[model samples]
Structure formats: C-alpha cells, structure tokens
Target: MSNSSTYTTRFPLLAKADTPAALRTVPGEHLGELAAEIRAFLVEKVCATGGHLGPNLGVVELTLALHRVFDSPRDTIIFDIGHQAYVHKLLTGRFRDFDGLRQQGGLSGYPSRTESVHDLVENSHASTALSYADGLAKARRLSSEADRDRAVVAVIGDGALTGGLAWEALNNLGAAPERPVIVVINDNGRSYAPTTGALAVHLSDLRRQADGARPESNVFIELGFAYLGPVDGHDVSAIEEALHRAQDLGRPVVVHTVTTKGKGYEPAERDEADCLHAVGAVNPATARSSIPAGQSWTSVFGSELATLAAERDDLVAITASMLRPTGLHPMQEKLPDRVFDVGIAEQHAVASAAGLAMGGFHPVVAIYATFLNRALDQVLMDVALHRLPVTFVLDRAGITGPDGPSHHGVWDPSMLSAVPGLRIAAPRDTVQLAEQLREAVAMNDGPTVLRLPKATAGPPIPSLARMDGLDILHRTRSGPLDVLLIPAGPLASAALEAAVLLEDQGLGVTVADPRWILPVNAALPAHAARHRLVVTIEDALRTGGMGTALAQACQDLAVPTPVITLGLPTAFVQQGPRAALLAEAGLDGPGIVAAVLAAHPDRRPPSAWSATTLATTPRGRDDHH
Candidate 1:
C-alpha cells in the first residue's frame, strides 16, 4: 500500500492530534488510543523509510504525556539523544512528513531546528540536552517576558545519564536550587547497547526500590533536586501525574520514570541487543531489515579485530556505549574479558585506554569519528603526548548521511591533523581497513587512528606500486603527468574514474592513496613536483584537512606545483545520502573531472597558470557544505 494512502486512513487519532495544541485537546480517555495509533503510524512510516524505530516506539506514551503536561515552544522540551524525539515530531505537526524521514532534503532522523519551532536544540549528540535545559531555564528565569514562568523540561535517557556532561550539568542545575528545571530521567537502561558502569547499577537499584524493596537515600534528592517516583513510563496518566507534581514544585526536580527501550513493538522488545535500536528499511510486520546482507566496513573491521585479538593477548578493546555499532562486538564476544563498555563517556574511554596502554596493554578504542571529537583533549594530551600505543578505530569517518550535521565526521581530519605523534589512516577498501587495523595495533610508540566510512566496503583497488608507504593506484601509462591525484580513503574510486576521464581528454593523471594520511607522506611532495597540478580529494573539511596538509608539505619542499583541494566546506552538512552529499560537494568522479579541467594549466589561460590564480580559481563549489 502507498504510504500516503496508509497514512490517511490508518491513523485517525494521530490525524486529529497533529500538533501539541491539538494533542492537549485529546480526551484523556482516548489518549491511550492516540498513543497506540501513533506507535502504529511510526512502525508503518519509519520501517519503510528506515530510522530510530525502537527508541520512538518506546516513547509514544511518554511523548503524549509531555505534550499534554507542558506547552512546548514556550515550555521548552529538550530530548537528549534527539533520536528519541520521533514521537515529539509526530505530536508537533510532522506526522504528514513521516514518509520522507531521513531522505535527502526530507525530514531528519533526529530533531531539527529548521523543521519545527518545537525543536530548539538541533544537535543529536547524546548527553547535551540537560546542559541546554539548564541554560534555557536560567534564561527563562531572568527574562522580562510575561511568559518567563514557562517550564523547561529535559527528557534524557538513563543511557545518556552515563555521560560526564550530564553529571556536569546536573552539578550546576542542582547547585541552583531556585532554578525551575524539570529533569525527566527516561530510564530505558540502554544507549545503542545496554548501559554500563556504576550509574546503570544505581538506576537498577532505583528500579528495585520501585518494586517495594526499600526506600534508600535517592541520588537526585542528595543532588539538591526534589525527587519524584520511579513512575511507569509506559503509563501516560501516571507519567502526566508525575509531570504535574514536578511542574507544581516550581524548582529543580527529577522525575525518574522507568520504561522499556523498545516498549510497544514485540520484535524490538524481544531483540536482546539494543532492542533493535536503529534499523534500515524493514518489513513492517516482522520488523526484519530488508536491506540485503553485505560485507560492510564495520563488519570487516569487527572480523579482523576479532582475529587480531585471538592472536594477541595484549590487545584489548574499549567502546563508549557503542560496542556493537563501532564493530567491537566480534572482539567483545570472542574475548569478553578483554573488551570494556564505558557507557556514553568518550573522554573517559580514551583516557582510560591511555591508562591501559601505560599498564603494558595495547588498548584499541573503537568509536564513531564524530563522537571522537568529544575526546580530542584526551587524544592529544593523554594518548599522543604520552606516546601511548593506542589504536583508535574511528568508524563513520567521513560524510555520514541521514543523521545530519552533528553526526557527519568531516572535521576529524582537520581536528586531529595537528596532534603530534598521532598517525591517521584512511583506508580505501575492506582489505585496507583490515590491513590498517593490524598495522595500527602493531605500532607501540604512539597513537594510531584507522578511519572508515559508514558505507558498505567496496572491492579492493589494487595498487600499481608502493612508494614510501603510499599506494599508487593509477599512473600516466604513456604520457606526461599533468595532474597528481591524492584521494583519502574511499575517494580512491572517484579519483581513479576521474583519472580515466582526464587521460581520455589527453591529460595524464597519477592517482595515489596515502594509506596513513597524517604526517604528510615524505615521497608525495617530490612526486607532486612532476605534475603541473596536484589535486587532493577527501570526504573531510577542506580547511586544515589532508588537502591543506598536502599543500603545506609541497610548500615546505619548494615544489612549485599548483595544488587544488577538493573537499567539504567548513560548514555543517545537512541530512542526505552519502553519495549525493559527496557529489554535491564536488568530490565525485564527474565532479573531480570538472575540478581538474577548471584548474588544469592546459585548459585554463596562461594568466590562470600562476600559483595565486590557481589558488583563487573556483573549482568544486558546495555552499551547503
């Protein structure tokens, strides 16, 4: 059945409660029916489009209760790990746009400021909403507006509470006892995987206390905030009652609500691992993914790491609540004692890895490239400064699609390039990822980073030759080399295609993949001197990225070759397909051809051949990136 047709007839209650104002008007007796309908609608649309189905399904009743209790856009409701705000979106007149969820130029997977006024915080990074709520509440209290008394609610998952930022915000919010902030702890007990550390244990104890074990000294109470029940999150009326009490407090309060992660859906509830937290296109009825099984970069990394772990007793793994997602599950399953799940604390994970490395063990820290930004200080000071032999496996290293700006990892290269003693590797294929993983772990002097994209691994691009540890993928067969193409990671395919096209146009092009893209390969500047123009393509920020580093290397060597850098602009790239975003940023095969032709000395006028002219000339333009 068509989505439009299914959407129109299947959700009568959902249709009526299109907005929060309309949701407040929903009869209390029919609120249950509305929640059911919304869950059904979510399964129907989100399964087809692919999104955070499990988290959204779990929060149907909780979201409905929040809308009924607080006047949003005025009350200011912020959801930590914004993927859980799917139900909030449905309540805020976004139900009609569900069919286009996470698509290019469509509704985002997480909360988006541009999509609705209700969404104040656009960043979907976990454990940040509490801090935002704290700030917003303080702002509201000091405001002279008539509606300054409006409530500020922060609905954060128990998993998110594991993050250090949440505690930091809690410390500040609790210290200001006069501030009226409603901190709702949505205790689902999972973030991607099961929540770990002492916090989870404490929350588990709280859940036991709710079952009439004994009244213990509550942490929230000790933190200087009024504590409410460990209420049932799935019960809308019960949640609303707790919210009412919290609202009546007129001071900082904590409403601890117990809920299941994948509440309503049987498939999600039954799934042991992350409750099917995030999914691709799936069969709506069975809740089975429809995406055909393939060897993804993640799986390859996981497999290789597991193999490496079997061989080396000194190899251990650490993940910040992303054990399975970051491809550490294989190693975790094989050597359970060696793998550590540090909850949602990236900084702790990196610093702790450094500690482990200090104890004579090589700790492999598996994390998303985007999340690694949170631990930059630890990476630089704790690891790199100490010359710790820690391997950071950065998954989703480049232009990750769907999750949008905060999730796209285009800034890692720029951010980590200056970290002394840190080696960064951008693998071109699954083979390279495995090889690089092994090589990274083998290093004992300093930290190493192996970055790979979120896409499925492509066939290996065999190198024609290896020079100074660089893989020469393509070289001018029988003509003068006019352009030297340096592509980072998966962009080697596009560079190879552009090389073929440039060769056909009678311009000889040499393509090379600098396996370790950091510290500037020693042989690159010398080889680049042979070509008239050097083009560096990467799925990273153009500023201070591999391209800039390469250009700097040439300049240091007095290589007079004019360099053209093609990469994402230094801006937040929005939600879209990875390929589409790359093409838009002019990092694709045809785009590379256009960039090369525009900068080629033979194609451009003699006046344009000057270094200054080549630097200023427009090549690939992506204003959105």
Candidate 2:
C-alpha cells in the first residue's frame, strides 16, 4: 500500500492537510486519530532534529482545543517558557518549516515574532507569559478599540506560579474583575525537574480536588479569579469547554487543565528523569542519540562536585527546578538531604542559599548563568553583603547557542560585576573547572562563582606561568608584548589561535585564561604595561565585562597601553550554532585578528595591510617596556 493509504488506515483524519480550519472540521470519530497523528508528527520531526519532544507530545489535544476556541491573532495566546508551543506552532500554519526547529536561519525552538503575530511573547524564560499578557491586556483596555470581545490567554505550565512574576500579574489581574484574561495552567507537575515548593503543593491539592468543585481553600477563587476545572487536558473537547467557559466569564479566570508530561510517546513517558525535557538529534523510532565522546563541562563539574560533597559534611547543592540541566542532580543523589530543588524561584534559591551558608553549611547554588540574573539583588544584598560562603556554579555561561536571546547566559559577566566581594571564575577547560571548583568551595569569607560555557569539556592547555590567579597559557619572546589576549571560558581556543596568527605576523603575543575572571587581578596591569597594545577577548559583552575591567586596571596602574576589548556587541545575539555565532560576533580566531588589526592599523599583518596605509599608520611601537 502507498504511504498515504497506510497513514490513512492508521490516522484517517490526520493524513490530510492539517490546518486550523482542518483541525476544527475533524470529525468527532477521528479526534483520537488526529491526536495520534500530531503525536506521530512530533516524534518523527522533533526526535530527528532534537527538541522539547515530551512537552509537545503532552499538549497535542490541548493545542488543538486552544486553536479551535480562540482566534489566535485577534485573541492573544502567550505560552510561558515557549517549550510547549511546538504543538501550537504546528497547528498555526508552521507545520512545513518544523523540520528546521532550533537551526540557524530556520524556525526557532521557541516562538518568534517574525514567524507570526499569533506568537505574542518570544521569551523562553518560565513564568513570564502572564506579565506579558497583563501588559497586553492593559494596552488593549487603554486603546480606543477596548470594547471588543477579545480573549487574552496565557498558557502556563509546570508550576510557573512557583515564580513571583506570575503571582504579581495574577494579583493585579484577579483584583481587577473587569479585565478579561484566561489563565490556563497546563499542569504536568514539572519545571525541568519535578517542581518543589509550597506552590507546587497547592497545585497538587488543586489536582487532587474533584472536577468543577472548589477545594476547601482555593487560591484562584480567593485571589478573585473564577476557577473553572481540574479538567482532562488530554481530552480536546473537555479543554475546549473549559476554555469556552473562561471566554464567557468576561473577567479573570483560571482553567486548571491537568495533562500528562510527555503524554503519547513511550520513550518520553517511560523516562522519569525529566521525561526527556530536551533531547539531542536522535532516532525517531527508538529515541536514541549518541553521547559526546569525552565528558561535557557539565558532567565534569557534576562528577567533581559529587566527589567534593562526599568529603565535606557541610557541603550542600541547590538548584531552581534545573537538577539535571545544571549538573547538580548527581550531587543530589549522593547527598539527598543537602540538595535543594527550589522550584522555579531563583530569588528564593539565592536567599535560601544565603540562609544555608549562615547555618554554617557550604551551599553550592548550581544554576544557569542567565537565570542567576533573576536573583542578582538577593546575591548582592542577602549573599554578598553578609559575606556568605555560597559557591555559585553558573552553567551555560555564554552563547547558549540555539535557544535564542532570552536563554543566552552572556550577561552574567556584566551583571555580576556590580556585586562586591563576589569572586567569579571562568574556567577555560576541564582541568581548570576541577581546580576552580575546589577554590570556590574553599572560600569561606564571601561568595565564589564558577562560570562554564555550554559545550564539551576541552583538553587542558598547560600554563607556562601562573600570574596572580590567572593561567598564562602562551607567551612569546621576553622583550616586548604587542598583545595580551585574555579570553574567558568560551573563547579560549579562538584567543590561542589568534595569538599564533599574530605571532606569525611578527607580533609578540601573551595569551592567558584568568582563572578568576572577576576581582581584576592586581598584577594584570603591570603585566599589560609590557605590551604595545592589550587585546582582551571574551564572548560576553565587552562593555562591562572582564575586558572592560582589565582596561580600567591598565589605566589605574599608570600603564599607557591602549586596551582593545573583543567581545559580543551589546545586543541580543540571534539563534545559531555556537561557532557560527562566535564568528558573527567577532569572537573567533580570524575575527579576533581582524578586531586587533582594526584597533591598530600598523599592527595588521604585512599581507593584510597596503603600502599606503602602512606609510600613514602612526602606532604599534612599544614604548612602556
């Protein structure tokens, strides 16, 4: 039989052209077929490309119901953390481009504004949709066309209410009875890891309560929202009915529709550890993917930390709903009592980590670099001010490639610079990671941070000399230094390559990985003074990062060397491969050389610089040394 016929026999209604209208027209008999088809489609496409498969599979019917109930562009639907928006994208005229999910110049893993106006919020961060929806609703109310019956729907899943942002919006929205917004809680009892908090407990109680019957104390109802049902989210008609009720309310309402996390696919359903929240490129049928040959930076950190935890009785691990993702789960398994998964509340994570440290325990708060920004105030006031012995392992330090702007961890350097007494270490490779982990834990006076990029653990480059806390990886002849390249973790390889290139072009080079990137090494300025021009390279924004600090240090030490900082521009980097993004941002070897050349035209390689330019070029001769 033909493929069409075979698919028809299996999923009769779904084998045809699947559109919003087509989904709406699907016969009641074949609703199951359509759901199955969507699941099949997700498995076939998402598995091969590698994406948030389990989340999409869980929300097939819910997505269909949402599209059927709401006129998308007219009635705004904002998905919190956008990972569950795959089924929404599939139904909203983007099924064809689904093949290129998370790829460069392709459909984004998360919702994109360029793709459609239907995607109101592009933020991949959790528990943000409500705030966006609240703002949008306020704008709509202020506009002349405020009287229209347009629905504002915020689909939040996996205990997003555990966060303060959602609660703040909820308080405002619920207090104002006239403002219309349908808050759909896609309850699946997770947020990367199994969500743990008082809010998560409350949600559990809500889930346990009978359908359409308010619990003894309903938070939603008490908060001025018309609570609908603990409905079956997997059932399309049931969810549609709840949504219809919400739309008819003409006020703030919450339709608690509980669905399975990783619903249909066996591979995801069976796997209990996060239900394969995100996956690599894998076989569609078997859900199999090849693991990286060597240990990843995450795995290496995890292994080392676990060993450290085993030795130290006071050592504890903490995560904000990301156990496996940040590599803290291993330590958690080894020392269950000491590990804390603080739901989606990073603010709480920081504050509690401070508390733990105050209690004479060494708290290692392992979290994503981007997420650490959320709890900066807590880090500054609660942790740093108190001089707590809290070690922050910031995983995914820079250019978290394909997950787009909101997910990239590049802002940590700039943001963390403001924190007093906080020592930040950006490890270049696996060896440094282990060494720094020990250093971070050993510090009892103040907070220490270990920031690592999201990539495989590269082989160690032996240091020629240890200058202060920095590892001088490469050094040229003893005479004069034309350049001092100090690339942080992500751009270390590129900086070394650029040093080789500069050396070949008759330029003296010294490359280093400042093990402790923060606290600006006191000895760095004196070393930099020996250079004609100091080029500080990093993948973070050059504005307020390590490069800027070093440049300021040069001036502070009375060094005349002009510092050229090479880093990502102060803008949101687009989604792409890490290597490609680095090149585009001028963080690669060729790009670094170009940046150095651009800073000093006379220092450009002889082959690159023209005769006329060289004749007119004023600088490059080292005077300080």
Candidate 3:
C-alpha cells in the first residue's frame, strides 16, 4: 500500500483510544496483545514508508507501558537513539501522520521537538539521552517550583549504554541523590549485531534467569543509583509496575527491561542479531530479499581485509557495535580472536584501536560516518597525537536517505579535516575502496581514514589517468578550461555527468576525483591555476568539506580562480530519497550545470536555454564507492 493510503487508513489511531485494551488489562492478563498489535501496525506502516524497523519492533511493549503511566511533556521521556520511538509517536497523537514517516516535511524518523509536545527531546544520536536526562532532572531540582515536580526518564538501550558519554551521564546522575531521573535499560541483546564484551554477557545472564537473579548492578549501583528488574519487557503490566516502582523510589534508578529484537515477528525472533534493524523500500512480501545478492562495498572491504589479516596475523579488526552493517561480521567469523565488537562505543573503538596500533598490531576501526562523531576526541588524542597508523573504514559516509538529519554522513569530512596528519581517502568506486583500504592499511606514519557511501556499485567508468596528487577522470580538448570539477565521495558520477552536459554547451570542463582528497593535494593547485572557474562537489557539508579545503589551498597558492562549492547546506536536511536531497541542494546534474553557468556567465552559449543538449549527452558508467 502507498504511504498516503496507509496514513488515511491508520489516521484514527491519532485520538488516543478510550480505555484502550492495553490500558484496561491488568498487568499479567493478555499483556502481549497490545505489543502484537503495535508490531503488526509498525510492520504494515513502516514497511510502506521505510523507517527504523528493528528498533521499533524490539521496544513495542516498553514504549506502550511508559506512555500508559507517565504524563508526557509534563513528565519528560527522552529516548536514546530515538529511532525506536515509532510506538511512542503513534500513542502521542502522531498516528495519522505516521505513515508519512521520514518523507520531506513529514514526520521524522527520529523524535522531533517541533512535531509534538510529547517529544521532550529530538535526539537521534546515541548516548545522549542520559546526559539530557541529568540536565533536565537537575534543572527541575534547582527551580524548586511545585509544578516542576516532574520526572525525567531516559529510555536508553544496551547499545547506547556502551558509549562512554552514557557512562559519564550515569556517573553524574548517580552522584546526585536529590535528582529524580529514571534510567530504563531496554536490553534486547543486540546493537546492529549481537552486543559484545563481558558486560553484555553479564547482562544476558541476568535477563535469562527467571527468579531470584541478583541483579548484578555495577555501573549504576557502583555510582550509587538504585537498580531494579531484569523484567520481561513483553509484559506490559510488568513494565508499568517496574516504571512506577522506579518513579516512587524518588532517586536515580536503573530499570533493566529485557525484550526480544523483532519481538512479535516469528522470523525476527528465531534469527536473532538485531532482526531487520533497518529496512529499505521494497514490496512488503519480498522485503527480506530486497537487499541485493553479492557483495556490498562493506562486504568487499571486509572480505579483502580478512584476506589481509591472514597475511599479517597481527592485523586486528574493530567495530563500534556495527558488526553486521559495517561488514566486519565476515572478519569476526573467520578471525574471532582478532576481531573485536566493542558495542556502541565509538570512543572506545578508536582509542582501543589506537592502543592496538601502538602495541605493534595493525588495527582497522570500522564505523558509520555519523556514529564516528562521538569519537572525535579519541581519534585526535589517542590516535593522531600518538601518530598511530589506525585505518578507519567509514561506512555510510554521505547522504543516507530516510533516516534523516541524525543519520546523514555529511559532517565526517568536515570534522576529520580538523585532525592534523589524518590521511583521508574518498573512493569513487568499489575498486578504489578496496585499493584505498589496502593503501590505508599499509600506511604506518599516522592515522588513515577512508570514507565510502552506503551503495556498493556504480556505472563502470574506466580507470582514470593516475597523477601524483589526483586521478584525472576527464580533461577537455584544446579550449579555454572553463570549469574544474572536484568529485568527493560518490558524487564523482554526477560531476562527470555535469562535465559532459557542460561540454555539449561549448564550455570546456575538467573533472577529477581525488584518490586521497585530504590535506589539499598539490595537483589541485595546478588544476585550479589552469581553469577560469573551479567547482568542488562532495556529499558532505560545504562548510568544512573538500570545497572549503580546496578554496583554502587556492588562497595559500595565490590562485585567483572563482571557487563554486556544491554540497549539503548548513541547515539540517530532512529524510527522503538521496536523489531528492541532492537535487534540492543543487548538487544534481542540472543543478551542477546551472551553478557552473552562474559562476561563468560569459562562458555560456547565446542559446544555452533554447537548446538543452543534456538529454542527448552520452552517459558514462557511474562508478559509486
């Protein structure tokens, strides 16, 4: 069914059901019914629109129980990694618009403060809720307003708990005995892949026991917060009772609610390992088969890295709880001892990898571009400061559709650009990604970073002429060079296409996708010197992207070419198809051509508008990396 049709069909759920069956039912009697309904609703609605699937499925009952007891907006509920808040959205008067999920100007994939009053926080990033909870709780205490006697509840998952920031928040919350913040640990035993470490195994043991299980309280208890439950999360009444108990306790408390990933779905339950954590657009009946067969860029990297591991026994692989997504599962499967799944702890992933590198082993720290924001300090201090040659394979390092602002990998290049001596590589194709990975692994002087998009393949463009600094993909024939196109990440195809379009319009264009687009290549200076207009396009933000860097390089080199940058704008872009976002940002083929013409008005032909030759332009294979 179409999203619009589904929205119409499910609109009535907007008005909170009068004495809903879940609300009326006693703690134990048919508690799982509401959960079942929620799961079915989510599958039906989300599959059509393609929002966060595995997360919402796992926390169905827990979300229902929280809303049932707590008066939201008054009593704040902050969700860590808010992608799992679909059930929360449905109950809080957002049911009608739920099917319009993650579309442009529609309901966001993550919680949004603007959407409704029920949403206290709009955090999509992980390991941030606990800290927010601490601030809110403390602020309420200091105000001493009678109306401010509200509860601050942070629904943090086991995955988010792995982050050092979560621990820092926990420590502060625990230290403040006066503050009343309830920490709900939604333990599903997975974060992308099955969670790792002694803590995960310990939590698993606690959840498995039915009776008299001494809740091993280390992080919360050691810090002096009361800990409760290893409760069956599917039991709505049980969850309500636990939440009430924690609220009544009047101090910081940890309510560890144990649930199953892909709870109500039989397929999800049996398979395990974060069942269908995310789903792409596909026919609902064949959703499972939608992910194409054969290797993704991640799989290729993993397979090749694993082979590299065999040659060098000291080679170790690490991931920040993204074993499956980052394609490190194969490496883990082959070399269990060498591969480390560090849970949702990005800082630990980078720092630990640095330590491994320091200890005479080659460590590859693989992570999603967005998630790596949490580990900037560690990367700069522990890795780059020590000059450790840690290779970070950044997955999803560009515009990620549907997941929205928090999920977009647009800021990695900007942030990483600040780290001195960090060699950053943006591969244009799968072959380049593999080759770059090998190159990064071999580099021993300093930290090496390779950024690639979610896609695996693109049109098979022939290997470009390799110069010392840049790979010259295309060079215009004998004519005044009007434009120099710099391709960053997967946008190389678009740049090349734009070049072809401009070429037909009698504007000579030179296109280059820098193999290592970091620290400002020497060839960029020469290329910019030759062209009348210079344009740099990347999937990252324009503020500190390759465009800015190239512009800076030009300034340092005393070049006077007018630089036109094309990329994601400063503001947060909403979730939608990647093509839509690119077009909106004026980074698509026509957009690029338009921007180029705007910069070089004199270069445009007299009948530029009358004869649109873009359609007839011979298309090349898009080699996406």
lDDT of each: 0.87, 0.81, 0.79
Q: Which residue window of length 10 is worst by lDDT in model 2?
A: 616-625
Root-mean-square deviation per candidate: 3.3, 4.1, 4.6
**Candidate 2: pairs in clash:** none
Q: How far is candidate 2 from the true structure (C-alpha RMSD, Å)?
A: 4.1
lDDT of 2 by residue, 443-542 (tens): 9999999888888777787888886777888989655677888888757888889888877777788997887888788888887777777777776777
- How do the candidates rank by TM-score, highest first? 1, 2, 3
Please estimate how well model 3 matches the true structure, expressed as its whole-model Cα lDDT: 0.79
Which candidate, 2 or 3, has the higher TM-score?
2
Most accurate candidate by lDDT: 1
Error of 3 at 244 (Å): 2.1
Task: For candidate 3, list the clashing residue pairs, or say none.
Answer: 458-622, 459-621, 459-622
Candidate 1 lDDT over 1-625, as tens digits, reads 8765667688878888889999988889998888888878888888888889888888888999999999988889999989988999988989888878999889988888899999999868889998998898788778876656788899999999999999999999998977889999988878888888888998898888886855656788888898888999999999999999998888899999988877778999887887378888889899887668778899999999999999999999999999889888888888999999998999999999999999999999999999999999999999999999999989888899988888898888899998998999999998888888889999999999998899988898999989889999998878798989999999999999989977877898899999998978888889889989899998898878788888888888788898888888878888898998888787888778777777677795333324433442343432110
**Which whole-number lDDT from 0 to 100 does residue 178 have in model 1?**
73
